[model samples]
Target: MSATTTTAETAEPAPVHAESLARLLVAGERPPRPNALRTSLTFGWRAMLKIKHVPEQLFDVTAFPIMMVLMYTYLFGGALAGSPTQYLQYLLPGILVMSVVMITMYTGVSVNTDIEKGVFDRFRSLPIWRPSTMVGYLLGDALRYTIASIVMLAVGLLMGFRPDGGFMGVAAGVLLLLVFSFAFSWVWTMFGLLLRTEKSVMGVSMMVLFPLTFLSDIFVRPETMPGWLQAFVNNNPVTHVAAAVRGLMQGSWPSMEIAWSLGWAALLIAVFGPVTMRLYNRK
Candidate 1:
């Protein structure tokens, strides 16, 4: 009878001890919640690593701008400004803005790719803030945008496009372009969540971007268009961004144009950020 009791007591203690050990192990394995900045940086680093593995991912940013600058300056320079040098001065700023804005669409395309590949599920499983993933996507693309800007400007300089705004003005123009690009990224991010495939997101993004960009003063003066088309181009947000960038590069900052561009950026973020967050959470 005593042997039976001793066996039971020993077996009972083993189960309790096993439970205690399990609880401790679980506590150790669970990571502590990270702060927002740290979480964003973590995901941003993840994005950089992804880019490192696929350096060819930057071909659009690097090659597209160079090609556009050479083609447009050579093709349209004589007709537009009587010389390639003069036209480059006019075309580079607008092209810079257009190129950066166009690249922003990739942010959404990448996010959609992650979703389709079940990466978002893994991200959701992590303890970080949900928005951090999206923000990290944006942060990661920021480097790409900056690289595009530098490449475009370098090509422009080689092509004899000198900015009257000099260094400070050029810096201001680049800053404004970055701000607009960041805001534009959110629009794509929202689309990424709503769309099913990366290709669809990119298609819709280009469809929307091409029209706005082509119709705007990025390539030609609004006054040159039909009255109705001129009105639309004048009101287009891309027009304002181009105007602001041009003004800065030309050393004549247009206050009204800058204000309008900033207003549009604020409106984009206010409207799209929440919508994206809600959709992302639903997924």
Candidate 2:
């Protein structure tokens, strides 16, 4: 009996206290939750990291803007304004608006891609602010929009497109564009959460963007169009935004256009932002 007890004792492992085991596993108290801005910025950094890893993502911002400036400046210069240099002045700002606006659709594509990869599901399980993921996508794309705008401006300057608005006016114009773009992105975020596939997000974005962009006064004056088309173009929000940006760059304030653009941008955000969050929560 003594030998059997000794053998059993030798076979048993040492007992571990709950306190000691917990101390070994978790060393410190939990840290406070991060603020919304910090969380949003962190997610934004993640988006930027993606661009850093995939440098090819910059092609639309760089090469595409350069191509648009060259193609349109030369193509419409002779026929529309009698000279490339003369046409560039009228075309550059409008092109800047159109290019940046068109690229904003990619924000939806990125969101849909993340959703497809199940990245957003992991994000949702975290303790961070709910809308940070969506906001981060826009913040990242905002940087891209700024880059595309600068590229367009540089190409325009090389081709004799001068901004009479000088530095401040040009800066204000770009700022307005960024603000509008940020608000516009919420619409796509809603679509991103709603769509099942990246391709579907892209298809819908194209259909909406192409019509809004082409039907506006980006390429030509509204009066030059048929009366019915002119009415639509005149009332189009893109027209107000393009006009506001064009006016700001040319040294004209166009306060009414700016107001209209801001109003439209605010409307877009107010309507789409919550819808996106709702879809995100359900998703």
lDDT by residue (tens digit), candidate 2, 117-184: 99988999999999998998999899999999999898888878889999988999999999999999
The per-model lDDT (C-alpha) reads 0.91, 0.91
Instruction: Pick out the ten consecutive residues of candidate 1 with the lowest summed lDDT.
Output: 10-19
Cα error, candidate 1, residue 30 (Å): 7.9
Report clash pairs, candidate 1. Answer: none
Give candidate 1's whole-model lDDT.
0.91
Give candidate 1 misplaced runs (Cα > 4 Å): 1-32
Best by TM-score: 2
